[model samples]
Target: MSTTINSFNGDQQQSSSSPDVGDLEKHYIDAKAFILSATTKDGINLYDHLAHCISQLLADQPREGTDLVEDISKTIKSEATPAQHDTLRDRPAPDSEHSLAAEQKPLFEKVDHSEELDDEALQSPLPHILEQAYYFEQAGIGLGKDESYRIWLALKQLADKGQIDKLRFWGKIFGTQKNYFIAEAEQNVDDETDENELHEEAHISDDNRHPNEEEMDDEEDMLPKSTYKPPPVVPKEERGTGANKYTYYVCNHPGGVWVKLPIVTPAQISQARLIKHYFTGDLNKEITSYPAYPGTERNYLRAQVARISATSSVSPAGKFKFSEVN
Candidate 1:
């Protein structure tokens, strides 16, 4: 035998599954507040039209096996219209704009003293306040009447806010913070290093060593403090026996033959090609004509190599020529 589904009437039996109308109305009010807070009105009426649909949905329950809340929510959302949905989606929450404005006010506007006002009137200006106002008004380094007014207003605000004591404290130390005339005590790096070294030395002891620490210490002691040594200067007679100790370009002029050109600056490398132009018209053509060569042999100009070593110093004390070398 086949059985057919039977429909029952719950409202007539006083046992409907639908939520109470009062509860639905309360939810509608809260939902309206949330939607209105984030969005402006569109073509659809959000509250009146939505409330009407909600009332209908609550009074008439959905068919069998349907969700009561989901059906009511769907009915309410349908009233929003497509245009209203777009507006709600595009707009930010009203509370967010208000909070951003409050945060920016402190940075752009003068400090607020409304809290301390407490319905009381502002006090008369003190003697020091008038003096400061007068000084600013009269002194002509761009402190005009506007600045004077601002100063007076700030002072009055401070007094009204019960922050006059703080203002006085800051005034006492005016222009002293990080100023050249104020000598702030500074820590010396060398002194700190010496103190740290002393502390480390004081802590060092034979008893403090681990089992492998003695071996590490012995290895450290065997090693030299530094492995570096300056390259040995080759004798002038034995120019290329090993790598050239120091390469120099000797000046070809008879008066400046003793002078050796050293690539002391970065500019000399760049100006190598421009050497001809630099010395073409000058009396020092002999010195500038020769391009740089390695290993101390004079160019085709017959200039002798001046060997650079510890015993020798550059000739023509103040006559060193500089060039831009790439």
Candidate 2:
């Protein structure tokens, strides 16, 4: 019988009223206030339009490690040169175009107490919310919003509609997770030491030897049973033995490596190719042969193979570097 295959995506049913943001409502309201008052009644103007777009993008999800309130605005960028976002920096953090002679209500202070707002709100203004989303999407960084909870809920709803059990649903969602191997056609085995130890340790008197022969004939399971062969556990310095990098992340069998090269501009690509040529000299006669590293990491290869690719200029300085400062 042909069986029907189904999938779940319950987040689509969520509206602004959804409970996921219950605790965040106050922040949401305050943010909405800033956005609404920042623009005119026609909310669809570039100001509100961008905010709505980004808010919608993030509305249904939470980033892995990002605080929505903290990172949201920085990600927005106006589609203007050097960054039309600079306009927001000039005024009280409003996008430059929106900064007119209009009376500005400071969002940072509580009107009654007359307290000074923190410098964070003052200096780090998010010019346009939509611009941040656009730039982030273009930059190819993970939209680090957290949607795991909602996604899990979506899966639950799916199982209910399909009349499926938890195990079956898990199997369907992630394919069967085999955490054993078949011992010929009749048996399967688990991997543990004592239960799997050979009969050599059966050091008793010889009286029971021949009669118990049949028991020793049975197949035994070994610990660390058949798994995908992992990379060779070599010391860090052993890496890049014959290559440029002395250390690298292993992503494949025996000796795999993963390197990330910037793919932001053509000039960067050209530079990358040149670096590759420099490292992997031409085939003795060509005078300019591209270098070929041992593994299959595109970023690593690009660094030494293709110099003139548009993958290195997008993020520079502190914005795109992949290091965490203490």
Candidate 3:
């Protein structure tokens, strides 16, 4: 009985392992019919049809396992072909005309006079002043030696250039945009005359006034006239002993072009005292404020410097005495 039961179990396992011959024959027939129909319609052999089906299956499959290097190589190949074609088409011909000789330019030329200027600067009284400055520093009354020497050199250069009888380093004035390195110099009589003449040439006369001035005059005439005459404007003082005593040259930095400030007018000084405005570094900048300034920023700066010097200037006792002889 045990042998019979063992035999039955072996038969069941054999039946489960073996495939049905009828089902295999049916699948073979169906595959043959589909291949025949596909070949007849597409005019392609079974092998080509099978290969196309395999390619479609591969294309439809997810690319998650694709090789990164292969993709990059394919991308590079795809992009390189178009670029190569464009490059070949746009390539300049070897025989194309091109100017070989560009416009001839002169070589850079340097004309430095620093050494000569330095030698000349040493010949002035700056050395003596520099020596005295050391003692002044010891007494806590002057800038350090290095700073004093630098200022001395600058002052000497300014004196030589301006043909000044006397030159001194005026204190620096801080501004909003930039600071002024001031140099006070006593000008020669002839130089002052020449500057005055140049200013006269630049001054606009009533005879050649602008049309806008004429219109303004007409408008003033149409207005009601009153007998209230304003006080006559004061004449500008001479350059020897008053606010215009010394010609002021200002530069934003040392070793820069020193600009001679226009002589300050009394009107400018009066107006400057009324309104406070920060300096904009531009000499030609207009001052827009109550009791509008009569001149540009240069005039305003000059007035302020004059005011500061008058208020803060100090001298040793008996160094100067008031006199009414003039």
Candidate 4:
């Protein structure tokens, strides 16, 4: 994930007043770490604070940065309504034409800043940030709806260093309502914790607090979670391939938890060669590989190479040569 931030330094400078390359890298790297640690209650509050800061930065005009104190000083003296002052205090005027209220659309809106970048930033920094933010969340960073917006702000700043239309650019991440789902899932998990606590309280009187229960709690806290077992591989008939069809490989995941690659027959590769494109066989059968780290699930890793690893090869595992795929 940190490597993703490093790619920003390679971007061509878009503006003289743009954020320094080193500064951008440091901020994003720090922000990624901050998000990953934000699952606790205090951690969540700190995350929202960072999101608020990012929102303030987005509201400011290009290169001016956010100056809420000065803006409020001027607002108090002007004839602006109390409501207008409140709004300005939160967000500066957007680079594009839109009211502050409209600019703050729900997180899943169709807005994207990648289209606003020059070729270099578009192809490089912009995508790098998006990919990092995505995997960061998938790695159980647990970025809820609110924290996810910080990702939007970061991308917008990278795209048009001096200008971003808050309204026009306001859209959902990856064009999906995933943030909504993530928020709902978090709420459900939190509710379960509360329910468990209530159950414990109802059963235990003040004088009868079980020493065994306390010991169990401490033991549970000390123990690490077990290895995640993915759903049993149920090979689909249509996508099935003979064991000898193509060279098979597993992700060289550092933790030694790896999945079989979906069978791509030599015939399929041959046809793809003639067409000069990768073949999308049985699009529904794609198998995706998630970040190969502890505590991450393969299912949670979206946009992974899901298609290739649909079924395990019939050939003996760990018997293939890397040169065969080449």
Number of the predicted model whose lDDT against the real structure is largest: 3
TM-scores across all candidates?
0.16, 0.12, 0.54, 0.15
For candidate 3, report its TM-score. 0.54
| lDDT (tens digit, per residue) of candidate 1 on 1-326 | 12222224434445556678999999998887876565334544445655666677668855642556566656666655564334355666679547645543433356655566533344332345456656655765433555334344443433443312223201111111110010111122232222432443344434344467467577745654465765643322222222122223222111111222221211232333344322221212334344542212112111111111322545686688788799
Query: Over 4 Å off in model 2, which ranges?
Result: 1-114, 125-228, 232-326
lDDT comparison, 1 vs 2, better candidate: 1
Summing lDDT over every window of 10 consecutive residues in candidate 4, give the lowest-scoring window: 180-189
Q: Scored by CA lDDT, what does every candidate get?
A: 0.37, 0.31, 0.68, 0.36
On a 0 to 1 TM-score scale, where does candidate 2 land against the true structure? Answer: 0.12
* For model 3, the run of ten residues with the poorest summed lDDT: 99-108
lDDT of 2 by residue, 96-154 (tens): 33542121222222335266877642332112324444566678852223322222223
Q: How many clashes show up per model?
A: 11, 30, 0, 14
lDDT of 3: 0.68
Considering every candidate listed, which one attains the maximal TM-score? 3
Instruction: Please give the lDDT score at residue 315 for candidate 1.
Output: 66
Stretches > 4 Å off in candidate 4: 1-118, 121-124, 162-326
